[model samples]
Target: MELKNRHKKCINFDLDTKELLKYFPKGTRKPYALIKEFFEKQGFDHRQYSGYISKEPISDYKLTKIIHQLSIQYIWLKNCIKEFDVSNAPQTLSLKNQIYNSIEKEENKIYNQFIQKLRYYQSKKKILNSSTKIKYEKELLNLYQKLEKNHINLDEKSLKSMREIAKTKSLKR
Candidate 1:
């Protein structure tokens, strides 16, 4: 299995599949199979992969798609938190926080790459006017700002709250 041989496929099962199956009857065999294929393709241990696909650097297009999907999930989760009863609030919030952490991690990874690219562009002897450079700088700034806006910050306080909620939920169970 080589890195070049790995192809993107729809995954059906994830870490939460078992929990989700309690609510929905259909299992995600297709997606899970796809993930298994990816693991095999990469010569990784499928049992340990945990379905986190972006451990290696991904293409910009794939990154964009992931960010978009995460953003949509973030919005939906926020709405769910707002609308759900207090009894279920902790679980929803914990899930939301987890998603937020993922988004932030991805953004930070991309941001470092973005800066490296910009630095490389500067080091190269390319034809550029001051106006063009300014335009490029503004565009980069805008991209950073856009990513920042999409990121959800889960502070220490929130983590404490989530932990408390988890404990309470476990006690109830």
Candidate 2:
């Protein structure tokens, strides 16, 4: 693939960066096509272009891990590209910093709210004035234990009722 910076500086590598590289004139080049051609010379098939690759193939267990790794690689490559522009260096850095700061603020707000809820629950568990919280906790624990043992039949109606109760409790708060 040909990775070019805004300064017109370009670097070319094979599809896997392991094959032979033939330097071409800089103006216009199809990187994917070049890589495919290089692979063809190495007797490697292009799975996507050929009918050998199924459109929606069933993934085995090991393939799932491989796919996740490839997804991480794709994300990393995308991040690299987003920061690849050579011009307006200060503006690009400032934009990235602003985006990160906004994300951090949002995360902190959510974390604080979560901590508050946890503290409230902990205090309620300790107080136990009405005993209603104890009853609920006992029932929830029983249900959870049954679930862990695969003994509870979790039907839609029961799940819906539980969700409604949870929503009502949140609303009361």
Candidate 3:
């Protein structure tokens, strides 16, 4: 069977479903057949887009769960950046930006759901009362201060690499 088909209903199962199911009941299976049948009745997956499966159908609950997981991951990365020593500098910034970009590129609805949920939680719980928030903020402040200090950092490394490349080109000329 093809991994995906243009004419057949394209069932977009969670990419990580199999691994995630390990935490659930043994022999647990998602309602893949039900999803396919539902799409078939709706006349979906008839046309292809970009030579891949063209449609995505997911329940709001599942979408919320996926987004929540991603939000938690984003928060974790943010916390990591805060806790990371300034000596790590641009490497941490690069890593943080990579995570931020990945999260931003995800399905908009899912990302929005996450942001809403995060906001909801923040509203319900006072940031001042949350020890984790205080820790993250404090660490972030420290990191920012250290970053401002004279440090051989990521930008410097990139500049050095550029200079070396330019020197090599000049020698060739």
Candidate 4:
């Protein structure tokens, strides 16, 4: 394994549909079918990848951008899934509304807590040091994560996505 045996070669690689799902959840929550639906909804001809995409030689930089975009799309799709899904399901909208209300309530509750704590400190004339501020920001993020797990608007799709994003558990459990 000396420098005399150095190798500097890049072989051709073919991308597949699996590449599109590369950023998606890895386990049962991968939501392959749902992601496929999202691809179709976005008018991405993934099937054509086999015919044209694989045949073409993409630059390393371009391929990196493509994969990065796929990851972002996974995030965008999950966040917006409930909005579109809720619109599609009109029959039991009341239940959906309840979920939405609960989500809103949860958000407000957290916001109120933050404000109250801030005011309490202000009333005491206590200075919020840098470390405390950073800790507070992390705490806020944690609370928001918890609320969103019930999912934004408290809908099922968002909940599923949240579960996928969560490192601690999966929806399967």
Q: Tens-digit lDDT track for model 4 on 1-173?
A: 34333222122223233443555546424454555554444333344221112223334454356445655866634333322210111121127788879978877886566455444433443476756754654554465565556543444543453344343233324
Candidate 3 error regions (>4 Å)? 1-13, 18-29, 45-173
The models' CA-based lDDT, in order, is: 0.46, 0.40, 0.38, 0.43
Between prediction 3 and prediction 4, the one with superior lDDT is 4
Which model, 3 or 4, shows the larger TM-score?
4
- Clashes found in each candidate (C-alpha, N, C closer than 3 A): 4, 0, 0, 1
lDDT of 2 at 164: 57
Q: Each model's TM-score, in the order given?
A: 0.25, 0.25, 0.17, 0.24
Per-residue accuracy of model 1 over 32-144 as CA lDDT, tens digit each: 45546644554333433343233343344554465465446334233222121101111111277888799778887766654654554455415767567556555545554
Model 1 alpha-carbon miss at residue 168, Å: 55
| Best candidate (score: lDDT) | 1
- Candidate 2: which stretches are off by over 4 Å? 1-20, 24-93, 126-173
User: Which ranges in model 4 have alpha carbons more than 4 Å from their true place?
Assistant: 1-94, 125-173
Which scores better on lDDT, 1 or 2?
A: 1
**TM-score computed on alpha carbons, candidate 2:** 0.25
> Residue 36 in model 1: shift from native, Å?
46
| Candidate 1 C-alpha error for residue 25, in Å | 50
Write out the backbone clash pairs for model 2: none
